[model samples]
Target chain A: MLELVSQMFSYGFLNRALLVGTLVALCAALLGVSLVLKRYSMIGDGLSHVGFGALSVAMAMQLAPLAVAAPVVVLAAFLLLRISENSRIKGDAAIALIASSSLAIGVIVTSLTSGMNTDVYGYLFGSILAMGAGDVAASVVLSAAVLVLFVLFYNKIFAITFDEAFAQATGVNARGYNLLIALLTAVTIVVGMRIMGAMLISSLIIFPALTAMRVCRSFKGVVITSALVSVVCFFCGMVASFAFSTPAGASIVVANLSAFLLFALVGALRGKLPG
Target chain B: MALISCKGVSLRYENRLAVEDASFEIEAGDYVCIVGENGSGKSTLLKGLLGLKSPDAGSISYGDGLEQRMIGYLPQQTVVQKDFPASVYEVVLSGCLNRRGMRPFYSPAERQIAGRNIERLSIGGLRKKSYRDLSGGQQQRVLLARALCATEKLLLLDEPVTGLDPVVTAELYALIRQLNREGVTVVMVSHDIVCAVHNAGKILHMGTGVLFYGRAEDYPDSEVGRRFLGGDHHA
Candidate 1:
C-alpha cells in the first residue's frame, strides 16, 4: 500500500487530480452548508445535469467544455429558481424537470455526436485523467473566487439563510444573496463535475455538508468542518481508488458516506449520554 | 408625532386581500398588540408597517426616526427557521446585519449590542447552543434577543408565542412586557386575546375591517371588540 501510494503521487496526472479535487471539494462543501440549510442542495444535482448537457453540446461544437458549461449551468440555476417561484412547480419539482431533461439531452447529444472521445467513460463515471494542467489552473482561480466571495458575504448569507423575509425586512437584500448563492452553487457544480463526474458531483456538495451537520452545532463550525472533511475524504477516496483499481468518483462518495455514518453514530451516542 | 400611522391601507397576497383598507396610528413608546383570528391580516398589517408589503390603497408613514431597516421583526413560527444550523449567538448577532451595510464583518459596536441583548434576554448561557435543539420557549427567547440587537426603538413580533406550555408562555410574556416597560416600543401580533388585553397598552384588532384600534381598556367596551372577542375577558 505504501509503495502504491508513493508511486501514485509520482504521476503528474494523479497529482493534478488530487490538486483540483481538493480545491473543488473545499468549494463545494462551503457552498453546500448554505444550500443544504435552504433546502436547495438538490440544485447541485440539477445544475450538474445541466452542465452535462452543456458539456456534450460544447464537445459537439468543438468548444471549451468548462467555458460553455459554466454560464449555461448558472443560467439554468437561476431559471430553476424563477420557475419554482413564479410557476406552479415548486423547487424540488422544478429541479427534477430540468435535471431529467438535461440528462436526456446529454445522452441524446452524446449518442448523436458519436465522437471518438475516450474520456466519455471518465466523464460519466470518474477518471484521474480528467484533470489537465489548464483545468488545474482554472480550478484554482475559480475555487479562490468562491472562497473570497463566501467570506465577503458571510454575514449577509447567514442572515438570508436563517430567515429571508426577516433579512429583507432589515434591508439585507435577500434577493441579492439568493442570487449569490445560486451563482456560487452553479460554478461549484460545474467545476466539481470534471473530477467527480456529472453523475456523482452532487454527492460532494451534499455528503460533506450533511456529515458535518451531525457533529457541528453552528454554521461556522459546520462550514469549517465540512471543508476539512471534504478535502480529506477526496484524498482518501482517491488513494483507495488507486490502490483497489476502483472508480475515482464512487470511491470518494463512498468515503464521504462512511464518514457520515461514523459521525451519525457518534452523534447518536452523544445524544444518549446524560449532559 | 406618532411613530407610525397607516391610512386606508390595503395589503394583498397575490390578488387576495390580506389586509383591507386598514388605518391606525402607533405613538412613540406604545405597546401595541394586533389581535385577530387566522387570515384576518394581522401579519399582513405588520408587513405593511415594516415595508415588506405595499398597501394597495393607502399609505404608511414613519416618524420619530423610524426607517425600513431600523425596526426589529420577529417572524412567526416556521419549520425551516426552527431547523436552521446556527448557534444562539449567531442567530442573535444576525440581527445586526442591517447596521452592517455593505461591509463584510460585524463592527465592535454591533457585537457589543448583540452581547448586551443576549444578557438582557437572559440567554447568555445558551449563546453557544444549537438553535434547533432548543425548546420552543428557548428558541423564542433567542429570537427575541436577536430582534433586540436590531433596534431599541421599535420591535415587531408576529405571533411571538404560538406554541408553548403555560409556564413558557407566561415567561415569554413577562420578558416582552419588561422590554416594553424599558421603553422599547413594541407591536406584537398574537391570537391570545387575553394576553393582548393584559400586557398591551394598546390593541389593534384586525378583521374584515379595522374593527378596533385604541387603548386596551377601550377594546372590550367597543361594539366590534365585544363581538370579536366573543365577550370573553379572561386573562
Candidate 2:
C-alpha cells in the first residue's frame, strides 16, 4: 500500500491533483466550520447546483466551465442573500428555491447539448485522475482568495453567525458580512466542483465540520480540527481510489462519512459510560 | 437629556400594524419598563428604536454624537439548536467585534474589555462552557455580559425573563436595577406588570400603540394601566 501511494505521488499528474485537492480541502474545511455553525449547510448544496447549471451552460457555449460557473454561481448566491433578507422568506426556503431551479435548468441544458461533450462525466462525478496543470492553477488561486477573506472577516462573521440582530446592534454591518459569506461560499463551490462534483460537494463541506464539532471546544479549535480532517480524508481517499480503482470524488466522500460515523460512535459510547 | 425620541412611530408589517402611532421619549439615565400583552408590539418597538425596522409614518432620532456602540441590546434567550458549538466566552467576545477594529485579530484592549464584562456579570467560570449547555438564566447573563461588552450607556432588553424561574428572574432584575443605578439607561420589555411596577421607575403602558408613558406612580392611576394591571390599587 505504501509503495503504491509513493508511486502515485511520484507521478506529475497525481502530484498536481494532490496539491490542488489539499489546498481546496483546507479552504473548504475552514469556511465549513462557519457554515455548519450558522446552520447554513444547505447553502453549500444550493451553490453547487448553481455551479452545475453554469457548467452545463458553459459546455454548450464552448467556454471554460470554472470561469462560467464562478460568476454565475456567485451571482445566484447574491440573489439568494437578497431574497432571504426580505424577512418574508427564510434562509432555508431561499436555498431550496435556488437549488431546485438550478438543478432543473442544468439537467435540461445538459440534455439539449448532447453529443458535444462525451467526457462530461468528469465534471459530474469528478476525475482527479484526469486533472491538468490548468485545473491546479485555478484551484490554488481560488483557495488563496478564500483564505484571505476568511482571515480578514473572522470576528464579524463569528458575531453574525451567533446572533445576526445582535451583531447589527453592535454595528457590525451584518448584511454586508452575510452577503460576503454567501459570495465566498459560491466561489468555494465553483472551485470545489472539479474535485467533488455538484452532487457530492456539500458532503465535503459538512462532514469535516460536524466531526470537528464533536471534539473541539472553541471555534478556532473547530476550524483547525476540520481542516486537518479534510486533509487526512482527501489524502486517504485519493490513495484508496488509486489502489482500489474507484472514483476519486466518491472515495473522498466515503472516507469523510466513515470518519464522521466513527467519531459519532465514540462520542455515543463515551456518553454512555460513567464519568 | 432625551437620548432616544420617537414621534408617532407606527410600525406595520404589510397590512397589519404592529405598533400604531406610538410616541415616547427615553431620557438619559432613566430605567423604563415596557409592559404589554403578547402582540402588543413590545419587541417591535425595541426593533424600531434600534433602527432594525422603519416606522411607517413617524420619526425616531438618537442623541447627536452618541456612538452607535453605546446602545447595547439583550434579545430574548433563543433556544439555539444543541448542535451549535460556540463557547460562552466566544459568544460574549463577539459583542466587542465592532470595537476590535477592522483587523482580523482581536487587540489586547478588546480582550481586556471582554474579560472585564464577563467578570462583572459573574460568569467568568462559565467562559469555556458551550453556550447551549448553559441554563436559561445563565444564557441570559451571558448575553447581558455581551451587551455590556459593547457599551455602558444604554441597554435594551426584549422579554429577558421568559423561561427562567422566579428566583433567577429576581436575580436578573436585581442586576438590571443595579446597572440602572450605576447610570446606564435601560429600556426593557416585560410581560410581568408587577415586576415592572416594582423595579422600573418609568413605565410605558403599551397595548397596540403608546397608551401611556410616565412614572409608574402616574401609570397605575391611568385608565389603560388599570385594565392591563388588573385594576389593583398597588399596581
Candidate 3:
C-alpha cells in the first residue's frame, strides 16, 4: 500500500485527480446534507445530465468545455428551481423532464459529431487523465468558492432547509437561499462531472450524506461525518483504483456503499441497545 | 394601537380565491385566533399576516413599530422537517437568521438569545437533542422556542396543535396564554373554536371571507361564532 501510494503520487495526473476529487467530494457532501434532507437529492443527478449535454455541445463547438458547461448547467438548475416553484410540475417530475431531455440531447449530439470517440467515451464514464492543470486550477478555485459561500450562509441554509416558511417570515430570504443551494449544486455537479462522469457525479453528492445520516443524530454531526466519510471513501477508492486498475469513480462509490452498509448495521444495533 | 391591520384583504392560493375581502385588526398585546372550518381560509389569512402571502386585493399594514421581519412565525411541520437531522439548539438558533442580516455566522448575542428562549421554554435540557428525536409535544415546544428567538412582540402560529394529544394541546395553549399575559401578541390559526374562544381575546371567524371579527367575549353572541362554537359543542 505504501509503495502504491508513492507511485500514485508520483504521477501528475493522479495527483490532479486526487486534489480535484477530494475538493469536489467535500463540496458535494456539504451540499448533499441540505439536498438530501430537502428531498432534492435527484437534483444533483438531473444537473449532472445537464452538465453532460453542455459538455457534449461544447465539444462539438470546439469551445472551452468548463466555461460552456458551467453556465449552461447553472441555468438549467435555475430553470429546475423555477419549474418546481411555479407550475403544476412537481420537483421530481421536473428533474426527470430536464434530465431525460438533456441525456437525449447529449446522446444525439455525441452520435452526430463525435462518432463515439474515445473523448466522448472518457467523458461518458469519466477519466482521471482527462483533467489538465487549468482544469485543476478551476476546480480548486470553484470548490473553495463553494466552501466559502456555504460557510458564510450556514445559518440561513439551515433555517431555510429546516423550515422555509418560517425562514421567510423571519426575513431570511428563503427563496434566495434556495437559489443559492441550486447554484452551488450546479457548480459542484459541473466540477465533479470531469472526474466522476455525468452518469455517476451525483453519487458523490448523495452517498456520503446518506451514509453519515445512518449514524449521526444532529445536522452538524451529519455534515461533519458526511464530509469525513466522503473524503476518506474518495481517498481509499482512488488508492484501490490505482492498485487494481479499476475505474476511480466506481471504486469511490463502492467505498461509500460499504461505509453506508457498515453505518446502517451500527445504527440498527444502537437502536436495539437499552439506554 | 394596532400591530397589524388588514383592510378588505383578499389572498389567492394557486390562482384560486382562498380568502376574499377579509378585514381585521390585531391590537398590540392581543391574543387573536382566526377560526374556521377546513378550507375556510384561516391558514391563508395567517400567511397574509406573516407576509408570506401578499393580499391580492386590499392591503395589510403593520404599525406600532412592527415590521414583517420582526414577526415570529411557527408554521405547522412539513413532511421534510419531520425527519430533519438538526439539534434543538440549531433549530432555535436559526430563528435569529433574519436579524443576522449579511453576517455569515451567528453573533454571541444571537446565541445568548437562543439560549434564553430555550431556557424560557424550559427545553434547555433538550437543547443538544436532535429535533427529530423529540416527541410531538416536545417538537412543538422546540419550535415555539425558535419562534420566540425571532421576535419579542408578535407570534403567528398555523395549526400549532394539530398533531398533539389533548393533554399536550392544552399544555401548549396554556404556554401561549402565559406568553400572551407576559405581553407577547399572538395570532394563532386553529379549527378548535372552543379553545379559541377560551384563550383568545379576539376571534376572526371566516368562511372564504371575514364572517366576524370582534372581541372574543362577543364571539359567542355573533351568529357565525355561535354556529361554529355550537357545532364544536356537539362535536
Candidate 4:
C-alpha cells in the first residue's frame, strides 16, 4: 500500500488531481458552514443541477461546458434568492422549486443529445481520473476566488446567516450579502461538479459542516475544523480510489460519511458518559 | 410635535381591511402600549411604523434626521429549532453588524459594544451558550439585548412576552420601564390588557381602527375599552 501510494504521488496527473481536489474541498467546506447554518443546504443541490443543465445545453451547442454552466448557475441562484425573499413563498419551497425544475430540465436536455456525446455520463458521475491540466488550473482558480471572497466578507456573511433582519436593521445590506452568497454557491457548484458530479455534490457541501458542528463550539472553530476535515477526506478518498480503482466522486462522499458516522458515535457516547 | 404620527392610516389584505382609518400621534419619551385581540392590527401598526408595510392611505413622518439606527426592535419570540447551533454571543453580535456596514471584519470597538449590551441585559454569562439550548425566558433576554445593541432610544417590541412565565414577564416589563425612565421611548404591542394598563402611560385601544387613544386611566369607562375589556370593571 505504501509503495502504491508513493508511485501514485510520483505521477504528475495524480499530484495535480490531489492538489485541485484538496483546494476545492477546503473552499466548499468554508461555504458549507454558512449554508448549513442558514438551512440552505438545498441551494447547493439545486445549483448543482443548474450546472448540469447548463453543461447539457453547452454540449449540445459544442461550447465549453464551464463557460456555459457558470453564468447559468449564477443566474439561477440569483433568481432563487430573489424568489425566496418574495414573502409569498417560503424559502425552502423556493429551493425545492429550483431543485426539481433544474434537475428535470437537465435530464431532458441531456436525453435530447444522448446519441451525440458519449462523454455525458462522466459529467453526471464525475471523471476525476480523466482530469487534465486545464481542468486542474480551472479548479485552482475557482477555489482561490471562493477563498478570497469568503475571507473578505466573513463577518458580514456571518451576520446575515445568523439573523438577516437584524443585519438589515443595523445598515448592512442583507439582501446584497444574500445574493452574493447565492452567487458563491453557484460558482462552487459549477467548479465542484467536475470532481463530485452533479448528483453527489450536496453531500460534499453538507457532511463536513455537520462533522465540524458536532465537535466545535464557535463559528470560527466550525469553519477551521470543517476545512480540515474536508481536506483529509478528499485525500483519503483519492488514495482509496487510486488503489481499488473505484469511482472518485463516490469514494470521496463515502469517506466523508464514514467520518460523520465516527464523529456522531463519539458525540453520542460523550453525551451518555460522565465528564 | 409628535415624534411619529399616523393620519388616516388604513391597511388591507386582499379585500379585508385589517386597520381602517386609524390615526394617532406618539411623542418622544412616551410609553404607549397597544392592546387588542388577534387580527386587530396591533402588529400591523408596528410594521407600518417600522416601514415594513406601507399603509394604503396614510402618512407617517419621523423626527428630522432620525436614522433607522435610532430605533431598536424586539420581534416576537419565534420557536427556533433546537439544532440551530448559534451561540448567544454570535446572535447578539449580529446587532453590531448593522453598524459595521459591509466591512469584512468586526472592529474591536464593535465587539466591545456588543459585549457591553450583552452584559447590560444580564446575559453575559450565557454569551457562549447556544441560543437554541437556552430557555424561553433566556432567549427573550438575549434577543432584547441584541435589540439594545442597535439603539439606546426608541424601542419597539411586538408581543415581547408571549411564552415567558409571569415572573419573567414582570421582570421584562420592569426592565422596559427602567429603560423608559432613562429617556428611551417605548411602544409595545401586547394582548395582555391587564399588564398593558399597568405599564403603559398612554394606551391605544385598537380593534379594526383607533378605538381609543388616551391615558390608561381613562380607558375603563371608554366605549371601545368596554367592548375590549368586557365592561365588568373588575381586575
Which DockQ values do the candidates obtain, in the order shown? 0.81, 0.63, 0.87, 0.42
Question: Model 4: per-residue lDDT, tens digit, B1-235?
Answer: 7778889999866567888899898888899999888888888788777766678997877773456655777877533334656788877777766576556677888789889989888888898987766887888888788887777667888888888898999999998898889888899999889888889999998888988899988887787777677777543
Q: Which candidate leads in TM-score?
A: 3
The Cα local distance difference test for each model comes to 0.87, 0.83, 0.90, 0.81
In candidate 2, what are the lDDT values of residues B1-235, reduced to their tens digit?
A: 5788888889975678989988888888899999888888888888888777878888988884457556789976543434567788898888787676667778888888989989988998999987766788998899999898887688999988988899999999999999999888999999889999899999997778888889988877888887777876543
Quote the lDDT for A60 in model 2: 79
Question: For residues A1-275, could you state the per-residue lDDT of candidate 1 as single tens digits?
Answer: 78888899899999998888888899999889888888888888888888888988888778998899999999998887676556456778878988999978887887788753666666667677877788888888998899999999988888888888889889877777888888988988888888888899999999998999998899899989999999999999999999888989999999999999999999899989997
User: lDDT per residue, candidate 3, A53-143, as tens digits?
Assistant: 9999999999999999999999998988887776577878889988999988988998999777877777777889889999999999999
**What does candidate 4 score on TM?**
0.90
lDDT of 1: 0.87
Candidate 3: C-alpha RMSD to true structure equals: 1.8
Candidate 2: C-alpha RMSD to true structure equals 2.5
Backbone clash total for model 1 is 0
In candidate 4, position A115 carries an lDDT of 49
Query: Would you estimate the TM-scores of all the predictions?
Result: 0.96, 0.93, 0.97, 0.90
Which residue pairs show collisions in model 1? none
Best-to-worst TM-score order: 3, 1, 2, 4
Candidate number of the best DockQ: 3
- Over A86-204, each residue of candidate 4 has an lDDT whose tens digit, in order, gives 77778778787777787677677777876435466767777776467887788788888889999999878776776665565566777788888888888877888877788888888
- Clashes per model (N, Cα, C within 3 A): 0, 0, 0, 1
**RMSD in Å for all candidates:** 2.2, 2.5, 1.8, 3.0
